[model samples]
Target chain A: MIRTENLCKRYSRVEAVSDLNLDVRAGTVFGFVGENGAGKTTTMSILATLTQPTSGRAYVGGAEVTADAAAVRRQIGYMPDVFGVYDDLTVAEYLEFYGTAYGVTTPVIEARRAELLDMVRLTDKADAYVNTLSRGMQQRLGVARCLMHDPQVLILDEPASGLDPRSRIDMREIVKGLRERGKTVLISSHILPELADMCDEIGIIAHGKLVACAAVEVVAARANGQRQLAFDLLSGGQALAHAFRHERGVTDVLTCNETSVEILYSGSEEDQVALVRGVTLAGYPLKAVREVGASLEDLFLRLTEEPVLPSGA
Target chain B: MHNVLRGWVLHNPLLHKELRQRMRSGRTVLGLSMYLLIIGAVAFVFMYLNVQGQTLLLQPARTAELFTFLSYLQLALISFVTPGVAAGVISGERERQTLSVLLTTPLLPASVIFTKWVTSISFLSLLMIMTLPLYSIVFLFGGVAPSQVLAVFILQLITLGAIAGASIFWSTFIQRTGWSTVLSYATVGGIFLGAGVAGYLFDSLSTHMPDQGLWSMLSGICYTINPIYMQAALESSRGFFTPTFHNSLVESVFQTVKTHNLTSSGSWMFFMSVYVGGCLVLLGLCSWHLRPGTFAAAVRRFGRWLVR
Candidate 1:
């Protein structure tokens, strides 16, 4: 339902989104993971038809975002990162306004407004002023506003950001419900584990470029096959961590404590055994040597740390 | 076509929402009360000071004077209130961050601008209507005709519409409500008042005589748009109101060209067309830039063809 081809957005001298290619199939949740300034919001804005790309093309629901923006808007519901509301209007009035703006019939708007307010758990606050509601309630109201037209696609930028833990859980459940109802959602967050819990496929972006895109379990399985080693000693693990930087197949080193370090190693068993013996024989008082299970956090850290490649690479 | 008209005029969501919010506001109620009170007090005070316990009988000139004073007062108040009402229409939405979500709906940019314009002008219309009981003073004395009252209202509405349009343009051009309001006030003050001032300064500074062709035409325009001058003319024209205003367009244009100056009626027409019509044109340009339509696309294509 959403696709972009080499989408590039530039602001003066800075490239906000550089050659970003993305695809989200119908009826699936695609989580866009990136840190701040990693171009997640820019990409989402392009797909929402709010920002025109400097180069290349974006599409939502098979319509080009720029050329057929009205159609694209008709098909997709967009929730910006910041929750915006008309302060003086009541919750029901706010929803009614957007419904009429979207050309939804009055009957359908009332019916859907009731259903959506219930889904977002704000049915009781329907008559209350929007600004009087809590932040979480306002965020939920924003989601309800987008769904007023019963769109098939939803582009939510950082829907869970700045929410309390309970609010985050509530948002996750709402998104889960959306998926169950067969809506395509492209959600973005800088946090990976949050997306891991909800997304069917995850794309990790860094430096305005997408570095990795895969199904959740596929990325997790790749992490499972990773060869990382952890060490515990009496002291001076920092010095050995410095030494292991030159060690073969030791891709990256993380110093956990003064006496402990975790090494991302992809060497054969022979090299591993040799390294273990070398650490023990080096008079470091090695307490333990164990293989550390790789996680999505480790993979995300490793992927973001690497430099972006040239276009064709 | 019928449904579209109904939606725009009857079911316009933006207009309905704005009107509902503003009508429910305590400030609006307070403003209307204060406005009516001030106008009524000023009129009664004028009558008391001048009449000196005598009946208003045979006081046609005093009533006419009172009518013109009220018209000028209303014009000044409307001029001040218009920019404040309209300058925030678009930029406030942006500051609240609602404009982005609004654009992502099926609503056209034209509808948004039009509804905002109507919403604001309709409130001004309500204020004008509220002053009618006060205008009854003029009517009771039998100096002002019913048609003159309607004419005065129509003139005020047109002037206010033009000012509101300029405010909308500023609202669209600027992103923040604070600066948009500043520029909107500047536009009203500069266009209406500054035109007269600048024209006077030019006449003073120049060696050329005021009766010459271009200078006289330009000076005529300077007064036509000035509300004070238009209302002043409304007093004199109350006797005739230009019976020949229904003259053929060609004859009017020919007379304007032959005289090298605008007639009284020609002056108002010129003022209305230049201010209101010019605002409509510029506002259309701003809307097209905000939501580029087929005209822009076609222009780009034409440029490409020229390059080819």
Candidate 2:
């Protein structure tokens, strides 16, 4: 539902978004992972029709953002980072105002306002002033405001940036619900694990370029194939290392001490279990065994550490 | 056509939302009350001071003078307050980080600018309309005609459009509300005071020589550009109000024009077109500023045309 082709945005001398290409399919959650000034917000803004690219094109719902901006606007709901609410308005009134601004009818807005407030879990606080809500509640209200027009594509930039852990979880669930409702959501965040949990596809953007883009499971599977297995032995650590050094699935075993060894095992969990059973049956001292999972951070570092190609390339 | 008109009248969402928010605001309520109170107090106090140590009677001249005072007072207050009302329209949205979200809706820049203009002018209209009970003082005394009151209001409306256009232009051009407000006031003030001084110099230079056609016409143009001079003429014409005008450059030049066989309404028409045309130009500038890509695209097309 959202696509960018060689989109470049320059502000005076600084290139905020440089030759970026992206494709987000309909009805799937695409997480944009990047650090500050990685051009994530700029890319999202261009897709939302808020910023014009210096060159190339962007489209939402098959309409070019710059040429058919009004149509694209009708098809996408954009939530900006560091947004604010009208302090004088109540939560319901805020949603009602945005609904009206989006050209939603009174009757339609009245119905959607209730539904959206309920969806964001602000139904009970509907009559309360927006300024009275907490930060987390306000962020949720921002999401509700975006969904007020029922746009098919949602452009959310840093939706859970400043929230506490529980609030972040709440926001993650809200996004998960959006996916279930079949809305294409393009969300950018620094929270990789949360994105990993919620996104079907993840794109890592660095230095104003997309370095890696793929499904979460595919990336995780590639990273998970190499396991860091550690074992502490009461004795015979040399025997354990020698026994596992020649094993088919064991790549390398580093003997830490006379009583401990760590193995880099490229094997399935079942194979590792069988190998451990064989070691125990062979009567080598095996006090403990633990497999450490590869974190999203490790993947992010491995991806970003790769050499970036030239812009046109 | 009917649907378009109906949509503009009843279904303009930005206009509706702005009106709702403004009407419910305590600041708006306080502003209305304070505006009415100031006008009432000024009228009563002027009456008391004029009748001090004299027997109070229904004097036509006193009432007429009071009418002029009230009109000038209204003009001054509207001029000063309008920039505050409009200069923050766009920039405040930016400050709140709501501008991007607002733009990502189906609203074009023209629609948003139209809504801002309508909402600000509507608030000013409400303030003007609420002063009618006070204007009834002049009506009860039988000095001012209903048409004169209507004329004064129409002149005020034109002035409102002019100043509101400047405010909107500054609001679009500047990113900071503070700077926009300051520049808005400066624009209005520069037109009133700057044109007043320049018009005076031109009038003095051309008063004795009516045959100096170009100088006299230039002087007339300068006088017409000042909102204060225009309001003074509208208020003082045909005994609508008979107070001594502080700035006589426009009125004096207008009399010279009448001597040269030009109708008084000609002056009104000339300046009406000028103010309204200038307002449209400023609004166009505002729309251009709000949509940056429009400017860039124009530049690109111009470049390609130049090369061709």
Show where candidate 1 strays beyond 4 Å. A220-293, A310-313, B1-3, B202-211, B238-263, B293-308
The DockQ-based CAPRI class assigned to model 1 is medium
Record all residue pairs in model 2 with backbone atoms less than 3 Å apart, i.e. clashing: none
* lDDT of candidate 1 over B187-229, digit per residue (tens): 8888767975765554444437645656765656675666655
- How do the residues A1-313 of candidate 1 rate in per-residue lDDT, one tens digit apiece? 8888998999999898999888889999999877788899999988887888999999888899887777898998999998578867999999999999888999999999999999999999999999899888998888898899999999999988899999998999999999998999999986677788889998888888887777876765464444668999899888889889998888889656678999888777798999999988888889999875457777777777878744322
> After best superposition, candidate 2 residue A88: deviation in angstroms?
2.6
Model 2 clashes, total count: 0
Candidate 2 chain B worst ten-residue window by lDDT: B254-263
Q: What would the per-residue lDDT of candidate 2 be over residues B55-101, giving only the tens digit for each residue?
A: 45777777777787788889888998899999998888888887888
Tell the DockQ for candidate 1.
Answer: 0.53
lDDT of 2 by residue, A84-166 (tens): 77767899888887888787888999999988888889999999999899999999999999899899999999999999999
Q: DockQ: which candidate is best?
A: 2
